[model samples]
Target: MISTEQLAGFRYVQDLQDQPAALAATLDSLEASPAPGDMADGIVRGRFRRVVLTGMGSSFHALGPLHLRLIESGIYSLLVETSELVHYLPALVAPDSLLVVVSQSGESVEVIRLLEAAAGTAPVVAVTNTPSSTLARESQFVVETRAGEEATVSTKTYVASLAALEWLGAVLTGAGVPPVLRVFRSACAGMTEYLSGWPAHVESLTRFLEGVDHIFLVGRGRSLASAGTGGLILKEAAHFPAEGMSSAAFRHGPLEMVRPGLLLCVFAGDLPTIGLNRRLAADVSRGGGKVAWIGNDADLDALRVGVSAVEALPLMEILPVQMISLVLAARAGREPGAFVRLAKVTTIE
Candidate 1:
């Protein structure tokens, strides 16, 4: 198990510890700014033919829940990476489409290119941390997340954007804001409670992850947000090799990769497919791979995350993965989230 001494003072760890406060501040910002009522009305009246969601890295993965919510509400939503959206699908940026872009830095190279390519053709709604950035200044609508400055990785900004996106989803779907605000408050409280025991969580994960050389995070439904972002952060922060995919996709081919050194972290996502996720965990364990089932009712205490609403699961589900990253970084004797080659913002496409 990693000692508290080794984990202390890392900027990424500090960022992780700041998530609850950042989340609260983001919620406060959302409450102060009213939802874009005109845009919501336009969507309901079919002023916009479709919603295009795009971002890069964690920002891109963070759109999972919103994309699903938009589709479930009967809106035609396309989830695309900004790089692809800019290079291959510029036609989707027509005036009839609503573009929802998530970027913590707001000024990534692809985002800059996208904004230039868009050239105000579509009404853009940006979920970003930088209020003065090009994305915020040029967007027709903006939801700024108060994640403050993140020195490394995407701990606070990613989660804060999730909160903002959740509120945006509620407004765009005409689901009302009060209920989503309540969920946000509950999720922030849960994050605080969980992070308070960070040391124990890290230690427990250190033991649970013994001899695991690779990881696969799998889930269905909204939990895909965590699975996707979880894989990204694990590699970024710990330099660990990990992959995230839908649970069903795992059964098709990657399931064959299961072996003694492999760790399968399965999210028992929303009830619609929780049974399948649970069965996948069992099968992976039976195949001699280490299995960590992540959910409120997870069999392992180290992997359990307290989830209140299914909507909040995406926010809560990431806590255990954060702990795993700390453990893996400690095992590797490296400072977690210290970027060796990458910059915080992608200046080059």
Candidate 2:
């Protein structure tokens, strides 16, 4: 079993802790960089007709929030899994097209295939932590995340990817980088503050996981990306069964699965979706399922009385799932991050 302490992975969190300063630097550099019209001396944007975002596994799901940002800005972007993008979406490529591919290691098999498929037609932008990586060498434009490194499941790299892509999203739409930088700063501060309260949350959530057999995570917009990625992390770290889907999709059929042994984790995003998420939690609770609401919609205000924004943010939005996974691991007597079969880099085709 992966130990809870081992799962905590102090160095991983420390690396994540160190990311805010690095991310701030990246934002500063990006601000000094030319606008969308100015990238590649303005020649690249003129030839590209569409932006296709591709990756695999967590790398692919990381593109979810960015896709929402692009669509909201009306910049015409597509988020396709790399395998399908290489085989079916080949026709969408042109010299004018922009394909931004993300990989932590810059070595996923599908990412390599997609790069090959986009070879001549679309100019490639590779976002990676490794500058010497294969993807970086092949890309016409490369955005290095500068996350330093990561261990266990992706902590800093994923956050850095979000920060980097969010900046690019703003650039693609001709928006100032400061606003994006502001949000990243807030998120970082929130996450940093959130970790302090983990010990208590871990203790309290054990009861919720006592007999739960299935867990479902739902979100929409940018929250959806976190919800899905969160689900994957819980599965990977705790060796549990977890499902991530859209909030609307929960209503269509999955809501029926709510029962005494089921757990529903919903991420409350901005505005209307927040209300919808609360209602979903209520729905699950009404059906006798255990419901843990994260984000602003959760009723943690009573417990959150003395918490700071940094501490509150992760508890409200990020740490609950981590706590829940920890609880589940304890109940199953499993170690937190005991990887038996999966390797860090997925080399197989």
TM-score of 2: 0.86
Give per-model TM-scores.
0.98, 0.86
Clash-forming residue pairs, model 1:
none
Error of 1 at 306 (Å): 1.0
Please give, for residues 1-349, the per-residue lDDT of candidate 2 as tens digits. Answer: 3354654665433543455555555556565655445443333345556688888766777788778767776667788887888778778666766888999999878877777777776788888878898899988878778777666566567767777787777667677778777766665555555556665566566654677898898877766776777788788867889988898999999888888988888776666566877788887899999876676435653123122232112223545665666677767776654566777777777
lDDT of 2 at 26: 58
Displacement of the residue 257 alpha carbon in candidate 1, Å: 0.7
Q: After TM-score superposition, what is the CA distance of residue 26 in candidate 1 from its true location, in Å?
A: 0.6
> For residues 1-349, what per-residue lDDT tens digits would candidate 1 score against the true structure?
3467768778888899999999999999999997899999989998999999999999988999999999999999999999999999988989889999999999999999989978758889999999999999889999999899999898899999998998999999999888998998999999999898898888777778899999999999888899999999999999999999999999999999999999999998877898888889989999999989999898766678888788898888998999899999889888888999999989998
Worst 10 residues of 2 by lDDT: 302-311
Candidate 1 total steric clashes: 0
